[model samples]
Target: MNRTLLIIAMFCSASTFAQSPVINNAEIDGSGAQYQGNLGVNQAAGDLQQQANARAIAVGHGASATTQIRQRLRTVVDPRIDARSSIQGDSFSHGNGVLGVNQSAGASNQQANAVRISIGTQPQSIDDSVLRQQNVTLIINSDPTDSEPGYRQIATSDQAFTGSRGVIQLNQSAGVGNRTANTLSVRVTD
Candidate 1:
């Protein structure tokens, strides 16, 4: 029978080239979508899969926050003051990682604020080749008197690494005061 079907087609092509590459199905679906920013996947004899979905607000690398309020009445002078502040950070990794964040604020009658965050990871398996990384940071500061002196700050970072080993980085910052002493920043170093 043709030499037993050519030895079962050479043992099914050597078991499909020694079988070992799987991630069956990957998906990212958004109906009525507003925003979908970043995603990556790799497969060409080496395997890597990654997915990040639905992000309204994302920050990385050096982070911070601060908010404020103050009021005064004449003559006998009555001062009623209200103050507010905030800060946040995030980092993610599979192998070889670093993340960071910091924030600050100050006022005359006195109001101050700060925030910071960091994350890291290393050593992964399942074919022994995959190093993924992500970092975020933000900072804000504010000061107000005679409705003139004020400041705000923001910072951030982001990264993604894959099979032949992939890597990514992102950062952002914004500061406002003194009739809009404005600043907004961004950095991406592959």
Candidate 2:
């Protein structure tokens, strides 16, 4: 009798596991918008909210060289992210976010040294993910060469001007053999 009951229970459990996956209702909601299914969204705060995000994530080993590399981590330079937003929204505001900048004036003085870094090895069974909320900007900049030079600077004069809106300026200067990390974080404001 016990053997027969075990067989019946096994069959019942098997039937339950054979069903297909299902989602009764798929939905997403944000300020001034609703999505029944995944499509798109509009940031209401702007007449046209222009947003950009640049994120790079690597997991597992690099399957190119000899034995697979379990994991490698790295960061470079006086990394700096900056932006100032106060203008009203336009009818339609758009953005063109680029991953590469090739020039001599803007991002010309950037040097990256041996950026070999190792954080940790992932567990046998594990997962990783990252999520970013609204108006989040990350800026990494500064000297990649951490070597201080014995060069002398000629006496320079400072200029002064009158401002009405109350100027807010961030002036950062890093000498040789220096590491700088700058993060401008602003919370939600009504």
Which candidate comes out best when scored by TM-score?
Answer: 2
Name the weakest run of 10 consecutive residues (lDDT summed) in model 2: 99-108
Q: What tens-digit string does per-residue lDDT give for candidate 1 at 1-190?
A: 9999999999888977886633222111221112122322111110121112111122343321121222221121112222122222222233232221112122111111111122213211222111122222122224354553223333222322221112222222222110111111222222
Candidate 2 local lDDT, residue 66: 14
What lDDT would candidate 1 get against the real structure? 0.23
Q: TM-score of each candidate?
A: 0.16, 0.18
Compare the candidates by lDDT and give the number of the best one. 1
Sequence-dependent TM-score of model 2: 0.18
Question: Where in model 2 is the C-alpha error above 4 Å?
Answer: 1-149, 152-157, 160-175
lDDT of every model, 2 decimals: 0.23, 0.22
Clashes of 1: 29
